[model samples]
Target: MTTPRLEGRIAVITGGASGIGQAVAQRFAEEGADILLTDLAPCDATVALVQGLGRKAHQMRMDATSEADCDRMVEMAVQVFGRIDVAVFSAGVKTLPEAPRPGVDPAKATQLVHMSVENFRKVIDVNVTGVMLGSRAVARQMLAQGTGGAIVNIASTAGRIPLAGGGSYCVSKAGVIMLTKVMALELAQTGIRVNAVGPGYTSTPMWDAPEDSDAYRRAMSITPMQRNGTPREQADACLYLACDESSFMTGQTLHPAGGQFTG
Candidate 1:
């Protein structure tokens, strides 16, 4: 029951401003890891949260899809923390049925089939390419450090099974799962591990219509747990997969999926 499993390690978490990403940063800090959190905009709030937990941390703005941004974020973490033992790709955007923004909602404003091609490409780029860039960038530094490390990508159960309204999101997550396997193979020589977390119906603010979202509730109903999982539970799973406790594990997906995906 030692709480400091990650004492002295440095971890960089992207998309740490909200949802599962935020939870992971907080939990990692609690485990004694010095952290760096980045998001599309400023990560000030996440920075404050981690520091409030009595751990050292810094925040940066990053767009994971940009190689330059990803590299910069990793470089800053290494410079500040001296090394990067872990990198977690947890930033993602979703496409809900009732999205109000023209870019987000397909059916709104009678734009179902009329949605911009740019919007679809944006979702795929951020969700899939973003994970790849972050993982690869941090891995290079880890290889140079030559101590080996871990990388965790946040994927969804939607990738495992499917969600009716999660068009591009589902595709993007599926790509993430595959990318993990590929990266794991390529990085094995360095003792670096690559893995993914497939979250079930998680009870996070990211679930568009929270209390009354029928589509979200419908996803939960199929779970054997019969309820949504909390961010902390999923965060713990991410922590386990990120730590040496899972030393024998690599190139696989750890599902905190509430029995939702029998596969």
Candidate 2:
């Protein structure tokens, strides 16, 4: 029998309720890992998807920004799967920071001014701080278990861009990249690995199109691949971080940007 890539491993994936997170949950389950899926909202659908794959699965409503809640989720993962072999922090929130006042004309050039402090902070709280809390707690657990594991923090190309007043989301993702490096260093002694996946203009339902409800044709035209990526493509990248094929790798960012940066 072929050895499944993630056979017998245990994983905790946050933001598992939808989009990329849901994609990861499905991919991991197919790889033969028991999974604990968490999100701020009910995860019944995700839970069903995983279990339907004939894998052991558990779901819980999680508020990633809460320290206490994060602690509990980690605890639950250990109790459910005995040890966590992989952790993928995929929860994120996005909005154009100074998104011209609702209903404003898009053709008019709007000043990319500083967005409301409250709005900026809110994005940072969930995207950046949440990734930190999840990584920290899971690292502690993996260390105590005496078994090395992998961590995949989802980042974005926006992390490397100015993003106008959409600064909060971009900065938060950049912080995730740096945190992945620092944590890889801190956990090197424990044999655990850490990395990040940076995706650009993915075809997730978050961005809708007029015809097929996909990405704008204009955006796809710029990508070297001439198309946005599927959630599975990004999830496959996460799997590399979770699996042993990347055993020698750590503290890196895997760009699944479809060559958006090259040209």
Candidate 3:
């Protein structure tokens, strides 16, 4: 039998309630890692999936934007699992959840110039600042343990290839990529590795446009693969970066972008 890549490891995943984060939790568990899954939403289903894989799983509710919540989650992970070997910071937002202005098209609302300061700040706070806080807290724990750990931040192809109406999201993901590099450099000597996964047109709850919609069609046209990537596919990328398989890599991004960045 093939040995599990993450055997006996402990992984802490933010945004683990659904979508890419939940998928990462499941994948890690299947690789023999115990999981501490946290999200602003309930993580019961994700917990069940990990438990069904015969791996230990714990769930906690967290607001990634809050520094206290980020620190608390890391503390909880150490308390429950003893140590954290991997961390996937997947908590992020594309736009505000509130309905768009009555007369303005939703697409227009997302344009950089039209975007409200509140909306841009909210996305940055959750996507960029949240990753910073969580990574800081987890890195501290890893440093104290004196054992190396891996951090995988979820970025997006939009960070490199700007989306017409996704300015905030693009900016936030770009920030994440920079953050990953900076953290990796600072922690390289300490044996902690930091990397990013930039997925394009992934099929997740974050994507809700219909197949016939202009947004969906535009996404497909730009993706040479001409199909949305599954959460599992993206999770596989995260797995690579989190495992010893990527020991020589840090301060880099793995783009599972369906050829969106292809020349």
Candidate 4:
């Protein structure tokens, strides 16, 4: 009999309420991993899904932007499963649309810069700072355990290429990419590998606008595949990074953007 890929492993996932996070929890559970799911929203549904798959599951409400929450999440995982073998940092905020103004030309819409400072900071707080906190907390625990582990961050194609009206989100994700490299380099000696996955126009609530919405149309235009990626596809990339198949890989960013762009 063949052994399951993640058998006996304990996985921690943030933003596990829905979309890519929920999909990852399911995929990891199917691979036989016990899961600790956390999100700003209730993650009970994802927990139930994992339990149904015959794996141990636990859910906790966590605000990814809070340092205390990030620390608590790691402690909870250890309390429940004794150790964390993999962690996927997927909690993030979507790019907010620029507000409509009277008499503004639609032709130069992309050139308009009306984004607020508060909005920019909020996105960074959750995406960049949140990942930093999660990685730090998990790395500390893994170092104590002295067992190699994996850290997978969820970046976006927007991080590779600047998109109009996506200034804050783009910058935040770019920060995540660089942070992954730095984390990988620092933790290499400790046996903890760090990597990132960049998904392009994924099918998630973040882009839940109507198909005819400008955002959706814009995403479709730049994607070479002419379609948004599925959450499961993004989850598959996470699974690969979390598993031992990519043992020799670290400080890398895997672009699952359907030929949209490579970097």
Give lDDT per model, in order: 0.84, 0.84, 0.92, 0.89
Best by lDDT: 3
Estimate candidate 3's alpha-carbon lDDT, on a 0 to 1 scale.
0.92
- Tens-place lDDT per residue, model 1, 180-250, is 99999998888999999988878776764465677756876778876788888889999999999999888
Q: How close is each model in CA RMSD to the real structure?
A: 3.1, 2.8, 1.5, 2.2
Q: Order the candidates by lDDT, highest first.
A: 3, 4, 1, 2
Q: What is residue 135's positional error in candidate 4, in angstroms?
A: 1.0
lDDT-wise, the better of 3 and 4 is: 3
Q: CA shift at 39, candidate 4, in angstroms? A: 0.5
Off by over 4 Å in 4: 97-112
Q: How well does candidate 2 score on lDDT at residue 41?
A: 77
- Across residues 70-122, which tens digit of lDDT does each residue of candidate 3 receive? 99998899899899999999998886643577877775777877778888899
List candidate 1 segments past 4 Å from native: 1-3, 96-115
Worst 10 residues of 3 by lDDT: 95-104
Model 1's alpha-carbon lDDT is 0.84
Clashes of each: 0, 0, 0, 0
lDDT of 4 by residue, 13-39 (tens): 999998999999999999999999999
Model 4: per-residue Cα lDDT at residue 172: 92
